[model samples]
Target: MDAIREWLAGHKREVIRFAVLFMFLAVCLFGLGRLISGNTAETDTESLQLDETYLAASSVESDQTPVQPQESGPAQEIIIVDIKGAVKNPGVYQAEADMRVIDIIDLAGGLSETADADTVNLSQRVTDQMVIYIPAVGEAAERPIAVPENNLTEQEIGNEEAGTEKVDINTADAVLLQTLNGIGGKKAALIIAYREENGSFQTIEEIMEVSGIGEKTFEGFKNLITVGAK
Candidate 1:
């Protein structure tokens, strides 16, 4: 037992040296593993931060973007008028404001063969809701006299009482002349023709030179007619 003890005592230092070296290696390995784990955690944290930043930038861009507006439509314009008597077609029609009487007549299929074209003011401008009446050749003879207005002005009423405010024969058209008592379309036209041929009348008696306006007809309208100076 003493011999064996002597042998262990001799080898104790060597064994102790080997144990210290093993402990040092184990400690180095543990420290290296801890360092690797810490580096991995830091990389994961950096990646998460980058993702959060991208999401925040995208949200700001969406908030700053401008929205578009919807578009709208246009409006339409139209007019209406009434045409009657002696036209090829007669009725109410839709028309434009720029249209003239001639344009409206064409839309109404133009005048009938019996229409007295001279009586119509073809060049006149058409208005909304206006009534256009194209008369036949002899229609004026049957037309009832235009009734005098009951709401006449004081001067007009006084003129009516005194048989004054005569229509000037030199300048009056057929329509204006027809307003006089017993003057129809035929007689009115003859008066105009005679005036155009012979120029302006010098006196009230000069109107009798027209074929249809005899002394009897002149006498009837003399108080309501005038020969205005040339």
Candidate 2:
């Protein structure tokens, strides 16, 4: 018994060292497992963050709106006239009631270089269906349209009142005014526009205010045209 006790005391230190080594290995394995678990949790957190970002982007796309265009308004009635002149295109033209003779000239592409307008008046009040006639250069003096008297003819002894050329100021648009001596629809239109914009003219000479009328032309038409409240 005394010999066995002596051997056990000698080997006690070696056995204690082996136990300490085993305990250190167990602690290292547990720390490794904890690190692995923490990595998995971080990966899951990143995956959740990616899913949230995708959902937000999708929501923004789905919530986008569209735009619409606006519509236009209604149209107004415009009075037009026919102009035959030394203009580029001597033909019918459409103009507003208050449109000036200049407007018709513009529509006709303006007068040719040979358009002799030295004595012709251009700015005259006009009406619907008026005709504007512009003479060419070197054209001799114009002949007057004779106002025939209401004399009884062979078939008109007891007939009703004969048709007379009465001028309708309100309805005498440019085209109609063009038919008058020394005036076209443009001048007529100017007259009409002036009368409309500034009220009726107090005197026939007041027609000078139109775009192209001069003293001589106004004097020629002084006794011809009238201005009505209409």
Candidate 3:
């Protein structure tokens, strides 16, 4: 026991050195593990931030999409015409711009029993202020019973009755031009400007050359316009 004690005392410095080296190694291992864990946590946080940024960017891009334009067709136009003779409800009735005699006949409650359907041109296109006369069967007439609105004499009668005169587009002032159907202050000014820029209209149809004066607008005032000087 005395010899063992002497040997232990002699190796005490070596034992102390060994214990210090072991504690240093343990501390280095623990620091290395903590560094590795911290790096992993930081990488995960960066990856999460990247994912959130990508999602936010995608949402913003989706919200900024443009809308496509919607196409619109031409506006429908209404016309007035007179139906007489064998129609069930013969008088002035509203018609569409493209209505034919047969279509208007249906609008007037169809033809009467005595209507001479064969004598009339059912396929003819109806116009504003047109007179559709469905004559009685076997009836004889000298002049055409179905007179179109283009027949100037009938137009004169209508204008006279309505106390409206056909305006000369070539010479009419803005106030006079506004008297025509569908012609407002703006349209009248446009017409005058068009005439001053391009001279007087040679025909009534040339009025359509003015902006906002399409075929539909022209149709409303065609019968009430003239190119000739008043």
Predicted structure with the largest TM-score when compared to the true one: 3
Candidate 3, position 194, lDDT: 95
Which tens-of-lDDT digit does each residue in 131-191 have in candidate 3? 6667788776433555653353323322322343567899998766754545666888999
Residue 105 accuracy (lDDT) in model 2 = 78
TM-score result, candidate 3: 0.40
TM-score, model 2 to reference: 0.33
Candidate ranking (lDDT, best to worst): 3, 1, 2
Cα TM-score per model: 0.31, 0.33, 0.40
Pairs that collide, model 3: none
How does candidate 1 fare on TM-score?
0.31
Model 2: per-residue Cα lDDT over 42-136, one tens digit each: 99999999999999999998889755676775564575565655778866566677776667778889988888666455676445555555666
User: Which regions in candidate 2 have their CA more than 4 angstroms from the true location?
Assistant: 1-65, 75-79, 94-103, 116-230
Model 1 whole-model lDDT (C-alpha atoms): 0.69
Error of 2 at 192 (Å): 27
lDDT of 1 at 192: 85
| Backbone steric clashes in candidate 3, count | 0
Query: Model 1 over residues 93-120: C-alpha lDDT tens digits?
Result: 7777777788878999999999888877
Task: State the lDDT at 85 in candidate 1.
Answer: 65
